[model samples]
Structure formats: C-alpha cells, structure tokens
Target chain A: AQTVTQSQPEMSVQEAETVTLSCTYDTSESDYYLFWYKQPPSRQMILVIRQEAYKQQNATENRFSVNFQKAAKSFSLKISDSQLGDAAMYFCAYGRGGSEKLVFGKGTKLTVNP
Target chain B: GAGVSQSPSNKVTEKGKDVELRCDPISGHTALYWYRQRLGQGLEFLIYFQGNSAPDKSGLPSDRFSAERTGESVSTLTIQRTQQEDSAVYLCASSPTGYRNQPQHFGDGTRLSIL
Candidate 1:
C-alpha cells in the first residue's frame, strides 16, 4: 500500500512571498505519479501540479513548481509570489502507473495574508 | 458540460434515510471516480469505474454504499440507511483513459449532511 504524508497541518505566507509545503510518501513501486491538488472554500478540487517519478527534472507551472526527489520519496510544492487567491487546502496524492485510484495525504491549509 | 458536474450541491437528510448523489463527467473522459472528503480531512477514494471494466468497490466503507455508472457518461453513488459517519462531501472526478500523465478533473462536490 502507498501512503502520502503532509507534515504541516497549516501554513501562512505574506502576499508576494514564497511558501513551500512539504510532502513525503512510502511506496514500493518503481513507477508512479505525484500530484498536488488545491481545494478552495468552494470545495472544488483543482489540480495544482504533477510529477512523474521517472522524470528527473522537476515540474514547473508558472509560479508553481515542485521539488521532486524520487530517491528520498519526497515531493514538495513551492508556491512563489503567493497571492490571496492561493489560500486553500493543498493535498498531496500518489498513484501507481497502472492503478486507477489515488492515495491522498491529509491536507495542509494555506492562508495568504495581504 | 464544460466540466465535471455533480448534482445536489448540498443535501440534508435524516439518519436512516437513503440518498443518491449524481456525477456527470466530461464528455470525452473514460474514467470516473468517487471520493469522500470530511471536514478538515483528505480525500478518501470510494470507488472507480473505467470504461466498461468492472468497477472497483474495494475502497467502499461498507455494504451500505454502492455506486453504478451508466455506460461512460454519468454515475450515481447510493448510500442506504445513511449514518452520521456518512456525512461528508462526496466528490467526483474524471480522467482521460490510457494517458498516464492525464490529470483528473473534479466537480465542486455534493455536501451531504445527516441530521
């Protein structure tokens, strides 16, 4: 069984600053995918970023980037130039290459102060 | 629909009542998933359906909870004699099949409250 862990329960960052949310997982599979999902007050789960275990290069999406260390089983989300709209519950998830289900970690609530 | 849509944005039913939550996935998606999210908790995978394959009910909490998808378009999660523990937001997501890198698109979710 694969399990994701988000050590931080809550985090806050000032507007225009940077925030890094930590995530780690335990999986025996060699091929898998990692994802970060955001859920605002509206309760819609939106995909933030994705990282393929086979890819050595980190994935970047504009202000959102991931530091993926496959050997350490660590995948952290870095949000640069944070805005108020970035305040939400961020969840770290893991899925195997051939699996249809995703294992999610307890979310970390992020609050951006203006 | 332009995105995944869930019906009954909010549902309040007494304990012991049965409730049905609907999910309509994106037109071209071949995989649909059902999950439960309690307040301040992460997503709990409930069931999964892919194309015409047998649905995975391994994640379901109990026999009271069952789900079915008609063809590849829509799905319904039915909870019989709902309990207080069943009170949570039911979320639905869809993804493109055979694409390992595809991300799942989600609906806002249906919040079920048991009184």
Candidate 2:
C-alpha cells in the first residue's frame, strides 16, 4: 500500500511571491507516478503537475513545478509568482504505472495574500 | 459529455435508506473511477472501471457499497442501508486510459448527506 503525506496543513504566500508545499510518500514499487492537484473554492480537482519516479528531472508546468527526490521519497510542489487565484487546497497523490488507484495526501490549504 | 458529469449534484437521504449516484464519463474515455471525500479529509478510492474489463472494487469500504459501469460510458454507485457516516462527496473521474501517466479529469461531485 502506498501512502502520501502532506505535513503542512496550511501555507500562505504574498502575491507575486513563491511558495512551496511539502509532500512525502511510502511506496515499495520502483515504477510509479507522483502528482500535485489543486482544488479551488469551486471544489473542482485540477491537475497541477506530475513527475515520474524514473525521471530524475523535476516536472515544471508554467508557474507550478515539483522537486522530486526519489531517494528521499519526497515530492514537493513550488508555485512561483503566486497570485490570488492560487489560493486553494493542494494535494499530493501517488499511483503506479498500471494501477487505477491514486493514494492522496490530506492536503495543504494555500492562501495567497494581496 | 465534454467532461465527466455526475448527476444529482446534491442528494440527502435518511439513514438506512438506499442511494444511487450516477456518472457520465467523457466520450471516448476508457477509464472511470469513483472516490469518496469526507469533510476536511482527502479523497478515498472506491472503485474503478476500465473499458469492458472486470471492475475493481478493492477500495470499497464495505459490502454495502457497489458500483457498475456500462462499457466506457455511464456508471452508477449504489449504497444500500446508508449510514450517517456515509455522508460525503462522491466524485467521479475519467481518463483516456487507465495508465498512470494519463491525467484523470474529475467531475464537480455529488454531495451525499445521510441524516
């Protein structure tokens, strides 16, 4: 069984500043995928970024990027130039290549202050 | 539908009553998933469907919970003798494939309340 943990329950960043949300996971599988998802006030789950365990290089999508340390079993998400729209709940998820289940963390509430 | 669609956006039922939630996946999507989200908690996997293959019910919390998907289209999650603890948001997602690399698009979810 894989379990994702988000130690930070809440995070805040000033507008235009940067913020990082921490995430860690426990998985025995060597081949797997890590994902960051955002849920805004609308409560819609949106994919933020994704990183593959085999890919040593981190994944970046516009302002969202991930710091994936496979050896440490850590995958953190960084949001640069944060805006008010970035205020939401962020979740870290883990899943295997052929598996349909995604294990998710409790989530980190991000507050972007003006 | 253009995206995953969950019907009866909000449903309130009495305890011990049966409730059914429906999901319409995006056209052409081959994978469908059901998850439960309790207040202030993370999402929990419930069931999964891939094309016409045998559905995965391993994540179901109890025998009272069951789900069925028609090919690659609609899906229904049924809860028999619902309990107050069953109050939560039921979310549905669809992906082009069941592969981990494929991102799953989610629905707004059905808010189920068992009173």
Candidate 3:
C-alpha cells in the first residue's frame, strides 16, 4: 500500500515572499511520479508541478518548484514570489509507474497574507 | 468540451434516492477518473477508466457505488440509495494517457448534498 502525508495542515506566507510545504510518501515502487495540485475556491484543481522518480533534478514551473528527495521519499513545494492568487488547498499526490490512480495526501491550506 | 466537464455543478438530493453524476473527459484523452472529496478532506479515488480496459472499482467505498465509461469518452457514476455520508464533492479528471507522467486535468466538481 502507498500513502502520502502532508504534515502541514495550514501554512501562510507574506505576499511576494516564499513558502515551503512539506510532503512525504511511503511507496515500494522504484518508478513513480510525484505531483503538487492546487485547488482554489472555484473548485478547479490545477496541477502545480510534477517530479519523476528517476530524475535527479527537481522540477520547477514558473514560480513553483519542488525539492524532490527520492531517497527520503520527501517532495516539498516551494512557492517563490507568492501572490494572493496562491491561496488555496494544496495536495501532494503519488502515482506508481503502471498504476491508473494517484494516491493523495490530506492537503495543506495555504494563505497568502498581504 | 474544453478540459474535463462535469454536469450539475451542484446536486441536492434526499436520502434513499438514487443520483447519477456525469463526466465528460477532454477530447483525445484515453483515461478518466472519479474521486470523492468530503468536507475539509482530500480527494479519495473512486474508480478509473482507461481506454477499452475494464474499469477499476477497487477504490469504491461500497456496493451502492458504481461507474461506467464509454471507451474513455464519457463516464457516469451512480450511487444507489444515497446516504447522508454520500454528501460530498464528486470530482472527475482526465489525462492524455494513463501513463505516470501524464497529469490529470480536473473538473470544477459536483458538490452533492444529501438531505
């Protein structure tokens, strides 16, 4: 069985600043994928970033980046130049190479304070 | 149409009644998924449909819950004898392929409320 854990239930960062959300997962599969998703109040879940287990370099999408430590099974999201629009529920997810589904964490509520 | 589309953005039904939720995956997508998100909780995988393969119902919570997809195009999740606990946001997602690297595009979700 695989599980994703987001230790921070809630996180806040000043606008234009940076914040890091922690995530850890337990999986036996050597080949997998990790993702960060943001769900705004509109209810649309948007993919923030993704990291492939085989890759040694972390993934970055504009202001969003991930510190993927495969050995420790830790995938954290770092939001640089955070904006008010970044306020939402962030979820960490894992998907094994051949699996059809993604295992998601409980989620972290992020607030961008001005 | 554009992106994954889910009908009836909000549904309010009475307990014991049966309800059907619909999902329209993005064009050319080969995989579709169904998930449930309880209030203040993360999304829980319910079922998966990939191309012509048999649907995966392993994540389904109970016998009352079932889903069907027509060759990866559209999917409908039907919950029979709905209980209060069934009141939650039902979300649908689709991806270009079922591969691990493909990111799933999600719908706004149907907020189901059982009265």
Candidate 4:
C-alpha cells in the first residue's frame, strides 16, 4: 500500500511571492508517478504538475515546478509568482507504474494574500 | 461532452435508503475512476475502470458500496442502506489511458448527504 503525506494543513503566501508545499510518500514500487492537484472552492479538482519517478530531473510547468527526490521519497510543489487564483486546497498523489489507483494526501489549504 | 460529467450535482437521502450517483467520462477516454472525499479530508479511491479490464473495487470502504461502468461510457456508484457516515462528495475522473503517467481529468463531483 502507498501513502502520501502532506504535513502542512494550511499555508499562506503573499501575492507575487513564491511558495513551496511539502509532500512525502511511502511506496515499495520502484517505478511510479507523483502528482499535485488543486481544488478550489468550486470543488473542481485540477492537475497542477506531475513527476515521473524514473526521471531524475524535476518537472516544471511555467510557474509551477516540482522538487522530486525519489531516494528520499519526497515530492514537493513550488508555485512561483503566486496569484489569488492559486489559493486552493492542494493534494499530493502517488500512483504505481502499472496501477490504476492513485493514493492521495490529506491536502494543504493555501491562501494567497494580496 | 468536453469534460467528465456527473449528474445530480447534489443529492440528499435518508438513512437506510439507497442512492445512485452517475458519471459520464470524456469521449474516447479509456479509464474511469470513482472517489470519495469527506469534509476536510483527502480524496479516497473507490473504484476504477480501464477499457474492458475487470474493475478494481479494492478501495471501496465497505460492501455497501458498489459501482458499475458500461463499456467506456457511463458509470454508476450505488450505495445501499446509506449511513450518515456515507455523506461526502463523490468525485469521478477519467484519463485518455490507464497509464500511470496520464493525467486524469475530474468532474465537479456530486455532494451526497445522508440524513
């Protein structure tokens, strides 16, 4: 069984600043994938970024990037130039190479202050 | 039609009653998933459907929960003898394929309340 943990229950970032949300997971599988999802008040879950365990290089999507440390079982998401729209509940998820299920973390509520 | 669609955006039912939540995945998507998200908690996997493979029901919390997907189209999650604890947001998602790297697009979710 794989478990994802987000130690921070809530976080706040000033507008135009950068913020990093931490995530860690426990999985025995050598090959897997990590993902960060955002859910706004609308309750719509949106994919933020993803990292492949096999790829040593971290994944970056514009202002959104991930610091993936496979050896440490850590995958953290960094949001640069945070905006009000970035204020949402973020969840970290893990999925094995051959599995269809994704294990999710409890989530961290992020508030972007103006 | 464009993204995953779930019907009855909100549902309220009494205890011991049965309820069904529907999910319509994106066209041409080969994978569908069901998840439950309780208040202030993370999403919990409920069931998964990929192509013609046998659905994975391992994440279902109890026997009271059952889901069925017809081919690669619509899916329904049924809860029998619903309990108060069953009140949560039922979410549905679908991916182009079942591959681990593929991103799953999600629906707005149905807010189920068992009174």
DockQ of each: 0.73, 0.76, 0.82, 0.84
User: TM-score of model 2 relative to the true fold?
Assistant: 0.98
Q: Candidate 4 iRMS, in Å?
A: 0.9
Error of 4 at A23 (Å): 0.2
Task: Note the Cα lDDT for every prediction shown.
Answer: 0.95, 0.93, 0.94, 0.95
Any runs in candidate 3 off by more than 4 Å, and if so which?
none
Docking class of 3: high
- After superposing candidate 4 on the true structure, give the runs of residues whose Cα lies further than 4 Å from its correct spot: none
Of 3 and 4, the candidate ranking higher by DockQ: 4
DockQ of predicted candidate 3:
0.82
Which pairs of residues collide in candidate 1? none
Pairs of colliding residues, candidate 4: none
Docking class of 4: high
**Quick one: best DockQ, which candidate?**
4
Question: On residues B1-115, what C-alpha lDDT tens digit does candidate 1 reach at each position?
Answer: 6999999999999999999999999998999999999888899999999999999898999999999999999999999999999999999999988357479999999999999
TM-score of chain B of each: 0.97, 0.97, 0.97, 0.98
lDDT of 1 at B17: 99
What is the C-alpha RMSD, rounded to one decimal, of candidate 1? 0.9
Locate the minimum summed-lDDT window of 10 residues in model 4 chain B: B96-105
What does the TM-score come to for chain B in model 2? 0.97
| Tens-digit lDDT track of model 2 for A29-88 | 999999999998777799999888999999999999999999999999999999999999
Worst 10 residues of 3 chain B by lDDT: B94-103
Ranking by DockQ: 4, 3, 2, 1
